[model samples]
Target: MLKPKRTAGSRDLAAIEMRRSLAQRIKELTEEPGEHLTPIPGLSLYHRTSPTPCFRASYEPGLSIFVQGRKRILLGGTEYLCDGWSFLLSSIDVPAQSQIIEASEKTPLLSIFLRLDMPMVREVLSRDDIPEGPPSAHRQGLVVGETTVGLLRAAMRMLELLDTPEDIPFLSPLAHREILYHILRTPQAGRLRAIATSGDLVQRTGRAISWLRENYAKPLHMEALASTARMGVSTLHHQFRALTGMSPLQYQKQLRLQTARLRMLMDGFNATTAAYEVGYESVSQFSREYSRFFGLPPIRDVKALKNVNTALESVV
Candidate 1:
């Protein structure tokens, strides 16, 4: 028997239905105009009513799917833009600047974020049924790709569990595994697989990254990091930059500045104290670098953030 060819109209209708279903599910989960954590572990919903300025934050390993509006994420000098039909994946921890580039009061920005579990990914990869591919050397850890129907459906099933909490314990894990399988079958799978596989250059770089994350407040020595990753100094530097989009020193500086900002905002620390707490030797250098990174000095930036929070609270 011969199968009939599918028409473009049918395909467009399918895509429209997928987007509509996902948008409805997300809106049900997100009741307000902010990030909302769902019952399913590692799954969260985000809703924004208007476009916002770029904000700096650490993006851990995860997958983000947008069902409405669009976003721009800046990693070093590269910018990744994604809309309702696309998604973003981060294979490792990265410091990034993200902005909501498109949104409105009526048609808000709606999205879902699920933190990737490396252990589960590794288990899935170990199965003999998984396809094998050659490892990539120069690929960055962050990638944006179009979302597939299978992946989107699996994600929607996972979100559906939020409405029926009793079913989550048994079915959520399976749905998550299916989602990972679909991701591993994408074109950007090589980088994600390398992050979990042993002895791969990307995995070795991840080890170094783990070390830096653990000891970001300490003085860094390239030799020590290279030894820990079991790579030559030159190779380590090359691979680290290839994966992270920044040199090791620059990466450390981002961590320090971000941490200092948090300390001032949450712990009520002064500029000098926050600098010292994050391993800054010279307060003057810290202030200069902080201003350059955040576009304002410590006191002014902190004050502005507090004022914004206060105004939002008053409105609420």
Candidate 2:
């Protein structure tokens, strides 16, 4: 006997069920209200109860598949919302402000994040069968794309591998390839592709960005950065801004400030100590810039964060 033809409504219902199932899996894997690293390297699950204030955060090259809740992320100057209906992909490390805008005890935010392996992406892209995705019009480092059923299914397969750790070592790569292949086959693959392509301008600029991230505490030398990118100073500056929406100096500043903020908030570093630790020679100058960037001085900002944490802890 032949099966009955499925209607569009049935397809939509199936998709909804799959998302709910994925969300439940994430929630089960994360029994606490924090990040839970899985057996899969660089793959983690997150659960958050209640909305959160904006905080300084950095994105590694990764995929964020949000099965529930929503977040507001300001990357560079653009704002993106990551929710059950959308997936966020980052092609490189970037400093940004993010807030959990929709979450609660009754309906906590549950999601999966997988750090992208550039080498793996390149290998997958080299396959004879893989389609060359559409050329990107704007090559921003971070993009939010509407989720599709195929992508979800691939992600679900990866998540299931957690059930059999022994199988993961052999099977995880294949699953990772499928997830990446899904993205690469779409128009959204541009940044990931460009960065993975050897000697591509974006790839070179990505090297410069990585160097800046590693050495933000040291004095930035334009010549050294340009040399790392293997591009002229002017070209490096233009391309850096094109992909990251900031100059090299500006990116370094954000990285420095965010580092100092974390040190002060988490490591008991005072304002002057944090400032000098992050390569600021003058504490007063650091104070001025810190205030300008974070909307408050270091002491006040840290105090606010602690209080927020306390309130959240009490609720939890």
Candidate 3:
């Protein structure tokens, strides 16, 4: 791909340095194949080969960038992919499944995950000259965007702090803010701007999502949720579906099933118990839905996941 013309400014110089640093950091961090490393506070980096087609998992507000290979994510039946030149940004909580689709032993997939903290979001929003109005609603929680010089640079600086632990306490937050600024100034800024703003429809929808995440197993009333989000029931339903591509009920169901699967796999709960814990009342209904969602019966699915974990441990 042809390089975009670089501007002649100090920011440009800093951006170049930043990109070089990021590329080097990614190379060093990804040196070992099949390793997942959490290099810094709230940042998880990984290099993988032959990763499974992962199920839709609850995604916290975060930024995800792939330095090599590719990732495909499915959200609300929509598919999105990001590769070396692209990044995926989720500005709010979402239910999605993602997998490294283009990696092998010869060339492992490389990626980084950054946690989104509300304090930093507020700090970024506090700056003067804030952009006004709600950004257009985008249904896909994962968005693939062309990686810019600015963002690449900030990402590198953030990783560079890993080598200088002392600076992390002071510099990491600033670098993170720069990264967010880079994002807000990009073409996809509108989507993020919507997320950054307080009391916007998107942010309101985000509140509802947060509540469901914490109370997935508990029964929910539409009006109650609407009230919590500060929107009327009808408007909440319309905007929620517009932003997530699923009605509130569908979103809750996805969360319920995903959480139930985790309870079974990680906590070793029986299928019936897991289903009930996740708020499913009928064991038969749970079994049928679990099978449909996971493409295997609950017992078999748990067993398969355990086998996979065991095999990975053996290799390690």
lDDT of 2 by residue, 81-120 (tens): 7877677887667667789989988899988899988789
Candidate 1 lDDT over 1-316, as tens digits, reads: 1111344453376667888899987877777889998788899899987665566666788888888898888776677887877777887776677778787667888888999888898999899999997675536767787777777888888888887899988988898899898888776677668667634776777788888878999999999999999999999889888777888888888889988988898799999999999999999999999999999999999998788657645644
Between candidates 1 and 2, the lDDT winner = 2
Kindly report which residue stretches of model 3 are placed more than 4 angstroms away from their true locations once superposed.
Answer: 1-24, 27-44, 47-50, 102-106, 116-140, 304-316
Residue 79, candidate 1: Cα error in Å is: 1.8
lDDT of 1 at 69: 91
- Residue 160 lDDT, candidate 1, scale 0-100: 82
Best-first order by lDDT: 2, 1, 3
* Model 1 poorest ten-residue lDDT run: 1-10
lDDT of 3 by residue, 1-316 (tens): 2112233562455554654466557768667765455546678786776555466566677787666677777787787777766667776777777666677665557777888776787778777875643464555565666667778867887887888888887887888888888877766676666555535787888889889878888888999999999999998898787667788888888888888888888788998899899999899998998889889998998899888768755654
User: After TM-score superposition, what is the CA distance of residue 286 in candidate 3 from its true location, in Å?
Assistant: 1.1
C-alpha positional error of residue 62 in candidate 2 after TM-score superposition, expressed in Å: 2.2
Q: Is candidate 1 or candidate 3 better by lDDT?
A: 1
RMSD for each of the candidates: 6.0, 5.8, 5.4
Candidate 1 wrong stretches, greater than 4 Å: 1-11, 50-53, 103-105, 119-138, 198-204, 227-232, 262-271, 295-316
Task: Score each candidate by Cα lDDT.
Answer: 0.81, 0.82, 0.74
